[model samples]
Target: MSQGPAPRVLSDEALSELLGGQQFGTLATNKRSGHPHLTTMLYKWDPEARVLRFSTTADRIKVKQLRRDPRAALHVSGGDVWSFAVAEGEAEVSEVTTVPGDSTGQELLAMVRGSVDPADEDAFLQQLVDERRVVIRLKVQRLYGTALDVNG
Candidate 1:
């Protein structure tokens, strides 16, 4: 087999940029049998918090797996040039709570306002609230990525 070129290490800034721009990735969670269960998901990166978060319903298998085993990995890849990154982290799942008596679903609103039409914001928020989504926060323990060329 022909060997490929050595992968160049990505810097913290580069990784953060790639992560923030990546809207989707595969989340790897451990099933009870210790096998990997992979789920393609949409994620939001919080650079300031240094964590990655994704929304999913409370009853999802990934949530159950995470609750049982907090250890997880998120593999994100981007760039037509073939760049990829893997973040190994511990996860914490929490039920999303809105302010009491605030029927607007603040968290959901913030997440969808950019994509949903302004006039439909309320309806979208309501739909999200009805889903009872839980936010899974991944506390990155180690982040490493490689690209064909970092400067590219």
Candidate 2:
């Protein structure tokens, strides 16, 4: 009998690439009941800053959970079934955007617009205010992942 190949620990660069290359991931926040609250989120990865940014409504449960416990983990798929990555960090939620064109609104605009500007900048800002949007900044402290060697 022969033993099967074990999963290889992915390098830091590989992990960062996987996280940065993808826009969606599962965000796990610590609940008051000592369990994890998971939510599928669309996020922006800043490799240089080692931070993940998410734009969400201020009234969301995830926000409330994070407010109680700042610890969070983001799990991102590595473009294959055998590959994946998890980023653990402390999340800081911004104050809900109240006035249009405020700092929070501007940051939300950048996160949503990326390199392009929205068709109606004022309308976009107004919408951010109306939606009670907040930015969750996850400052990644540790990155770890593994890839299984299925091809022998």
Candidate 3:
């Protein structure tokens, strides 16, 4: 009998690539009971700043959880079942967008603009306010993951 190949530890570059290559990931926040609250979210990863940004409603439970406990982690798939990465950090939830074109709104604008350029920028900004949205900035402190060498 032969032992199977162990999962290969992903390098810093590989981990960053995996995180930046994908826009959707599982965001985990700590609940009051010390349990992990998981949410599937669309996020923007800034490799240079080591920050992950997410747009969410202010009334959402995740926002409440993050406000109470800033610790959070995001898990992103490496475009395959055998590879993945996790970014752990502290989250700072921005104030709900009350006025369009405000700082929080602007941050949301940048995150949305990364995916699609809204034709009506004003409408987009206003919509964010209407939805009571806020931006969550996760300052990534550590990144670690692994990839399995299946073919090897």
Best by TM-score: 3
Scored by lDDT, model 3 comes in at 0.93
TM-score for each model: 0.83, 0.93, 0.95
lDDT of 1 at 42: 92
Kindly report which residue stretches of model 1 are placed more than 4 angstroms away from their true locations once superposed: 1-4, 96-105, 150-152
Error of 1 at 59 (Å): 1.4
lDDT of 2 by residue, 83-120 (tens): 89999999999999999999999998888675546568
Clashing pairs in 1: none
Best first by lDDT, ranked: 3, 2, 1
Instruction: Tell how far residue 104 is off in model 1, in angstroms.
Output: 11
TM-score of 1: 0.83
Question: Ten-residue segment with the worst summed lDDT in candidate 2?
Answer: 110-119
Worst 10 residues of 1 by lDDT: 96-105
Model 2 C-alpha lDDT versus the unseen true structure:
0.93
- Cα error, candidate 2, residue 62 (Å): 0.9
- Distance from true location, Cα of 6 in model 3, Å: 1.1
Q: Which rank order by TM-score, best down to worst?
A: 3, 2, 1
